[model samples]
Target: MEIVEFGSDDSGLVARFVDVSNAVRRHDAPWQHLQTVHAATGMLRHGWDGEPAVPFLATHGGDDVAAGEWHVGNYDNLHIAWLTVDVHPAFRRRGHGTELLEALVDRTRSAGRTSVGGDGWDNELSRSFAARHGFEQKAVEVNRRQLLAEVDPALVDRLHAEAAAVAASYELVRCPARTPDDQLPVMAEMVSAINDAPIDDLDIEDEVFNAERVRAYEEAHAGRGITLHRLVARHRETGELAGQTVIGVDRERPHLGNQHDTSVVRAHRGHRLGLLLKTGMLQWLREVEPQIEEIDTWNAESNNFMIDVNEMLGYRIVGRALAFQKSLA
Candidate 1:
């Protein structure tokens, strides 16, 4: 097996890598939504979340058989490297994945990193690989999906009403398709609230969020043809941003949307702002993107508060995934 490192500019090879990765995901977890090559390429080329990617392709018989991408976090977690290795289902069990993983870990160690992190299905094969490779199970992330068609619009309205009753001091701001300039700074603060999410045993740093990072994130999504719908709660008294939630809908796949980053700052947690933000966006989507059928979200299993909110909003667990990490001793 020949492992060749592919550069960010190699769009052809990166597209092939995305093909292989999507194939693996579909075959391994059919319930999960497949990612777009455009998004993967954008992340690799543009470093979404401020982490540059190093992609490797494994070639055999003059064909790109398997692929892996290693990303070293630069924002705040420089000591950790995250890698995803996907061997085409047809090429699995031939030692390609093992080779790619070993090479990724070696590269991370060479870069003076302390640990390597990756996520995988909770299936037996993935669990066994992590066990055999000395990767410690750090956390379990639950992937949940909500069918919008089955969602009762009245439920959202009722939730909105209930939240409104208690959250009277907070005003909800709805930003469709783009973030307003006036809200950019507070949006950065809300983005930083994600750092409060349970990281479990994963050795990583808190992401630094500012207007610049928000713009880069917006650009990356736009490059992938994804439109974002956001709802942010602000305290009417102090004019402080309390909480926010975002839903991303792909133009190519209008039937599916992604639930990303629903967070409430520490000072504003007890006011049911999370429910307000989520339901507010759901109501907006019902009006704007009625074609969206389902929205998927992932949360750490330990996040009972968020899970409770999701459960209340009709999101059910579809699959279990694991985050694994290995320390370079």
Candidate 2:
């Protein structure tokens, strides 16, 4: 078996990697729940404008058989994000995962990064691999899903009414497609508020979630998969952006939903804008994306406010995962 590093807008090979990855874990997610070819290629080519991510494809027999999508960032915290390996069921235990991982870790050490971090579901393949590599289970992330089919329709209506009444001083607006170029700067500022939320064991550098990185996130991952609707609420008279919620649909198979983000600006708190924005967006999602069967979201376990809101909305815990780390030294 041969391991070859592929880079610089290798769209076709990247698509092949995604295909193999999807095929292997095909049933794990409700829908495909992944970026389309264009989105994946965009990341591979110039994610964060060459900020130290090198996606690799493992190939043999004139066919690209295995793939790894990983990032070698400062993590702005001296770590990594979403570091997962993909080996076709036909090619498991063939050592491709190890090769690709080692390559990135080696690169991180050489680049002066201080640590390596990763996360995976509380499933065998993930936990076993982490144990074998001496990575400890440092923190766990719990995932919860609320079945729209089981949720009380009347409750959704009442929540909408109460929330709308409280939020009446603001206007709920969904920016169709991307925000205009003129709005990008404020969008950046508004988006930065997200970092204010909680991340328990992940050593995320709080202040590093700045305008630059926020815009990078908005551009890279925001508007993909299904209808990417970023619902923002602006003060009615002042026209100042007050709160926001983003709901996503699985474009290929519309029945699945992902709550990308829901937040209220510091000043916008106390008004229940968080609840208002979320329920409003949920209503929009239900009506327009009715086929959506499941909507999943996560927050730090200690985040009582958001979790309470989610509980009220009927989101039930589904699975748990740990974000683990190892020092490169």
Lowest-scoring 10 consecutive residues by lDDT in candidate 2? Answer: 26-35
Record all residue pairs in model 1 with backbone atoms less than 3 Å apart, i.e. clashing: none
- In candidate 1, which residue ranges exceed 4 Å CA deviation? 7-11, 50-52, 176-183
Mind giving the per-residue lDDT tens digits that candidate 2 earns over 84-109? 66677676677766777777677767
What is the C-alpha lDDT profile of model 1 across 1-329, one tens digit per residue?
A: 88988765788887788788788888999997776776677667666544567888898887677888888755567788899888899888888889889999988989999888898999898899898899989999999999877788999899989988889999998865567787678788878999999989887778888887888788777766778887889899998888889998888888999998999999988888988888898888888998999999999999999999899989999999999998886
The count of residue-pair clashes in candidate 2 stands at 3
Report the number of the highest-lDDT candidate.
1
Q: Clashing residue pairs, candidate 2?
A: 226-251, 255-291, 255-292
lDDT of 1: 0.85
lDDT score of model 2?
0.71
Which 10 successive residues of model 1 have the least lDDT summed?
A: 43-52
For residue 232, model 2's alpha carbon misses the true position, in angstroms, by: 1.9
